[model samples]
Target: MDVLIVDDEPLARERLTRMVDQLDGYRVVGQAGDTASALGAISAQDPDVVLLDVRMPGEDGLSAAHQIGELDDPPAVIFCTAFDQYALDAFGTDAVGYLLKPVRAEQLLEVLEKARRPNKLQRQAKQTEASQSSHNGRSHISARTPRGVELIPLEEVRYFIADQKYVTVHHLKGEHLLDETLKELEEEFGNRFLRTHRSALVSVQHIQAMERNGDGHYQVRLADTEQRPPVSRRHAGALKDLLQKL
Candidate 1:
């Protein structure tokens, strides 16, 4: 089984790598010092399990785990932290194992075996439970690209336009094609994103103004983007009310 070790400390990562190397079937695929790098590694390497650290700079491991859960086929997470207080929170994320710092080789092997035991049905059940209980939504949206998985921060998103099966994410850097439906995006991010039309969802935080075109159809003008998604008659009233508040 492939394993990725994530920790801010180089020594910690080195320790985990050595332990994983000693295992018969497991090999260290990659190592990361922070959550961002860890996520990028996961996308590129597609490891079977991740030895994640609970606390780190920028986004913590818990938040990272939440985003990982959003992936279609996420690797099993095994949190390795110095503090035991995060045990409950870690388990709440459906983590396969939570190993305390200065992990013993035996404990590591045992948790790795435990991580391999869950079937698809069991994993799905745990994920469903975690989603229902955890009110916090995803901080970033992930899309698979030719290079690998690309993560777009919610703050950078301008709008999402649906065209058939794919939804194009308009963000600050550029656009990315996402394998998701508008309804799913709407349901998950209704508060931050306003449904301008059946085919589009605009970021409320990025709305610059609402205007009518020459044909007298309303459209939303979002900041930092030229694309103006048309406002459907059905959703126009709600958009107007929201614009008033903004």
Candidate 2:
């Protein structure tokens, strides 16, 4: 199992590194000291399990976990904290487990076993492949805005909104008005990205949860830190089924 250790303290990172080095079937691929650097490492290394600290200088571990969860294939997060009180809330981030600090070798071994399972790797590979294919197919998307020409990577887009002839790209950062029709982008990346509406083609990975609103319309919780998007009636059933399978 490839592993990454994320902790702000040098001593803590070293300790976890030694533990991972001692394990037979696991290897330490990378380590990071802050949320930004940790995210960079996660993108570059793609480790299977991330031994993460709860408290840090800038963004806390929970905040980083939320970012990681947005990725196409997030590594299994195991919170390593000195306190046990955070365990109950950790599940909201989809953490596989939590290990109290001054961690025991036996406990480390047990969680390592859990993290090394084949199913985890299989799912990760599938997501990686899907993301790669989706990215490859999206190179043709170019949008002309008042500022300049913007190149929209299909993977970065969360959804789109149509207004007559133009479609606006809705991403985590902001919106961009693209020249291509929604149907054109949808046709190119249909297998990897799903058209949740006539105007919207949402990346499957960013979808967090689905809910039936008071008016019986379905809505989707996006991986965005700010807000959730509406799942139009046309694609609501399919989105619900997709969420169930995940």
Instruction: Write down the TM-score of every candidate.
Output: 0.52, 0.53
Alpha carbon lDDT of each predicted model: 0.84, 0.74
| Model 1: CA > 4 A from native | 119-246
Which one wins on lDDT? 1
Please list all clashing residue pairs in model 1, or write none if there are none: none
Per-candidate clash tally: 0, 0
**lDDT value, residue 105 of candidate 1:** 97
